[model samples]
Target: MELHALLSYTFFLLFLFVIAGETVWANEEDRKVANGGFRPTKLFVFGDSYSDTGNNPKSLASSWKTPYGVTFPGKPAGRYSDGRILTDYVARFMGIKSPLPYQWKKYGENKLQYGINFACGGTGVFDTGNMQPNMSTQIGFLEGLIKQTVYTKRDLDSSLALVTVSGNDYGAYTASGGPEQGLPSFISRVVNQMGINLKRIHDMGVRKVVVTALQPVGCLPKQTIFSSYQQCNETDNSAATLHNQLLQQAVTTLNNSTKGSSFLVLDLFSSFNTVLKNKGDFTGSLKFDTPLKPCCVGKKGDANCGSLDENGKALYTVCNEPGSTFFWDSLHPSEAGWRAVYLTLRSSLNQIYN
Candidate 1:
């Protein structure tokens, strides 16, 4: 065989091996959960791109473009990242297939009976930069379902809701002449609104709700690219810490006020930090040496990611293996990176599952 053909075959074999190993790992995880005696029936998701599963209108999102879903499912399915996000993993942990995105309603109805995802990319509790639906609007979609009798009160009685408010609101705040000194107040407002949203969902009939604490926003590739993706900016992390603290307190207050501790908080910041600290062991199928580096990036400081000319000429270079890297782009994680975080969250979820 020619050198090129030989190299291609070798790479294919390696890819197959990595996929097989991940399958085994996932199976083991399932067995562990089963033995521990936990089973959850439904998962309802709401948030931004991180948990969005194609809810964004196709014309409005770059996630619908090529290379977004190159790693899994073979095409862009509207996920902000390369593959599954936290919603998919949480659905898996619940022992049910990932529920379809709310936008895919016409595609199937069986999954909708289980649950629906209401997340949209670039959305926040308050209107952010994007014209897409904000958290209130997203919940309005769910409320419409109830009003239309799509999801009956009984359906929601046994359901679980996963709410993610990643930092889009903060991003919007920073861009719109909002003072950095007032970020603490903004954080309070965000959490306060989040608590209201959670209560509304619970009151609407959902049994248990899980809200994710903000991840280490300052550590994302977008913020750390200047550091060559080697070190997290402590300043950013400190800000995130404040946000998480307020969120934790809000969650506790919500639970207490509800007279039942049905609310749960998933700590993404700590989990992401743990994976960053032990990067070697959590290598994805692609065996990336530096998981922090993005797999696809804009060229020459342009604002586009992996852009190409009209003739399809390449304008960006892809990393060696997307699976090996934790981040697929400046703002999101690779599937493997999400999987590692899911593993760490197994215990936290068990609290809700039980």
Candidate 2:
């Protein structure tokens, strides 16, 4: 690829690494049972790279390259972190192995019992520049599986759906010349579509569907790096705040109208805020000395976490201790960062059983 195009692609992937947050293993028995009566037997994931295991093709996605999954699985496994992500943690919390990625469906028949993941790294609710399937299309893929009997209504009834819509939509919007003054209206549109998507998943017979509220995009290393990794840009944060507020209202409406109110929001904005405020010092145990600084970065401009030079030499620098850094790249979080956020989210996640 030409340098310019490759650089754009890398930056695109970087900005889309939004649900970024895990690393520690909880005791298996601790997650053996849920707090509520409804226990999910399977997990169906949708949205972006945060939950994607290996959906995006290797040739184009950096997640399939070296240094991405170095902290876990011993190599790149299409997870955009040093190790596991929110999806894996959620599965662990439910006492189940992480579901196989949808890309592996034809090959891993026996693993279907866990569920399928349809998330792609550089995707969003709307078609972003990444060219991956949009949220509507991703959901359509699930619908196709149901039509093929890959998943039955009974399977969905016992399943939980995880929908992550971090910041790729906004990334796409801004990149496409969207005006800052018009951001609130665009955010409204995104949240409105998200509500519709949630209802669609529920209509497909999934008893519970959990969607993520927008995280504080301003706090990601992508934005903070411009400030010398010292502070966040409140303008981006205000946009995320608006998105979360609108999403909360939308979810409430969906719940009030649906039977059993199967819709839930993960409150990523609050979770991220808490973790960043504490600098990964969750419960006074976990700590990321440089919470806003990424663990891996390009050696120079336009390079990325996994960038390689023309001679195939690595052009990125990885931290000596990835576990101490919150972000793994310009946008995504390290496993330790995610683990800290998950600790705070565990109580909220337990509500899925209710």
Candidate 3:
């Protein structure tokens, strides 16, 4: 009887252990499902310089000049930053290579399997002064490719699209003599158009679409320069705040109306603010001791990072340690800066799979 009872107790404990192990496994799977087990096979990028890899014409843009891509590819490779941009980091997290730029599509046939980048530097939701294709035109390019069956429905079903506006439209508005009082109205127009663009991309059958909320334009080195790189311009920051609030409302409407939640905002405004506020304290191994100052600047009036004199003499000043600074130029973040931003965005990016 003692042996029998002992054997029964042993079996009962074994049974309990098996059940508990299975429960743990099931819970792990549920976690994965909630976090989005569906991985994207392709990544489509659309935006301005913030996402542009090499879409801009080499001869016409500063991105293709010396000291731009000096950190990563070791030479000018059309990225506006010292290294990779937001798109590259996002693709890496997705376990895919950064998609080829639309203009460079012909160079490699196999690369098309990953995706294509339609972003152009100095371009915006609306046509800016650069004369690059507007957002509407960029979308039309994808539509044309779909028509050609370059990407079948199967391809789009497993794909992701990234759309970034990044304040170029507002820049254009202010530059073209848009009145200060009318700024809020212009911001509305931009976001409304962006909503249409997002829906169009979704209707084209892409599985997931991620768009960026406008970053703090006031915190950029250009605006901060007025404060001797000590503080951001609160007036411009207020406008960015309004833009993000409107964008969030639009995204909420999109998700509620759709069958599934396919549209998401990257919240670049918050990410930038967080990184700037922390000043590399949270970003491991990367320090931005002087977060507001740019690594490169014009040596003289109006000369940009890659500007040259009539005699072809370089007219820009580059920092000795680009990795230590946040902004690479007055306008864009360095690779280190993007890395810090990416860290903050990882949690948000996971929603793509969900």
Candidate 4:
């Protein structure tokens, strides 16, 4: 009887251990699924400057210069603004580090797990203006990786993508003598190409894709400087609204056609407007007395922000505090400005996570 009692006690202890182990394992699995799991071990990015975390060549971009990265990392790490960009913030939200630039092949093995960013500043889907790789060629780079077996089917199944098609294509259109009268038609073409690019990315096996809608262009410092950066041109925002509406329709159609409705749109319009309305937040990073005003400007319209003379003298002047301004230069947002926009996107990301 004594031997039997001892044996029963041992079995009871074993049962408790099994239950505890199962609980821990279940919790881990829940976390993985909630954070998008191991399937997407990488994030493949393609877009313009808004998401370009240093894919542009050093010789070509002034982002490699000083004072561009004075805020966060305390050094120029190739990010366009004072610190992190949309890609970096999104990567953090997805529980992964921002990937290396595709051009930086030297760090390939070390950064392979996170994926790559192929975005080049001043690029668009149609190649309407800039000489950089169009959306298709950017995907070609991804295809080259696959051909080399750098990423497998399983990797893609678990991977996600962020595509940004800022208004560069439209800007290019206007620069190339495309008439304002044909702006609506050109906008449609841009969205159509973007939709095609989305389909191509999905077809290439990325499980989820998030794209940004155009921000308020007229509100950009370059455009609103005429109004002293204190007001947003409703005319430009109206154009953005029309573009976003068409983009929404495109996304809906893509979702209906795709296997799992994987396409998501990040609304930059509302996000930018939110911060502009609030002036600044608790951090005091953006104290925009004149929100549309850019921190740097050319002295005599000789060059835009980041311009340097033959002797390397700066042609533009910076404001007292870049953190106090919404527009970084004439085109992009300050880091603080992007952070404000990121706050507004929290809910949209939640949809993707769910």
Q: How many residue pairs clash in each candidate at the backbone level?
A: 0, 4, 0, 3
Candidate 3 collision pairs: none
Models 1 onward score TM values of 0.87, 0.90, 0.89, 0.85
Q: Write down the RMSD of candidate 1 (Cα, Å).
A: 9.4
* lDDT (0 to 1) per candidate: 0.76, 0.83, 0.83, 0.75
Q: Please tell me which model should have the higher TM-score, number 1 or number 4.
A: 1
Using TM-score as the measure, the top candidate is 2
Report the error of model 3 at residue 185, Å.
0.4
Candidate 3 structure quality by residue, lDDT tens digits, 136-187: 8999989999998899999999999999888999999999999999999999
lDDT of 1 by residue, 203-282 (tens): 88888999988889888889898998888889888988888888888888888887566788899998888787778334
Query: What TM-score would candidate 2 get against the native?
Result: 0.90
Clashes of 2: 4
Count steric clashes of candidate 1.
Answer: 0
**Candidate 1 Cα outliers beyond 4 Å, as residue runs:** 1-28, 31-39, 107-109, 280-288, 310-312
The segments of candidate 2 whose C-alpha lies over 4 angstroms from its true place after superposition are 1-36, 107-109
Q: Rank the candidates by TM-score, best first.
A: 2, 3, 1, 4
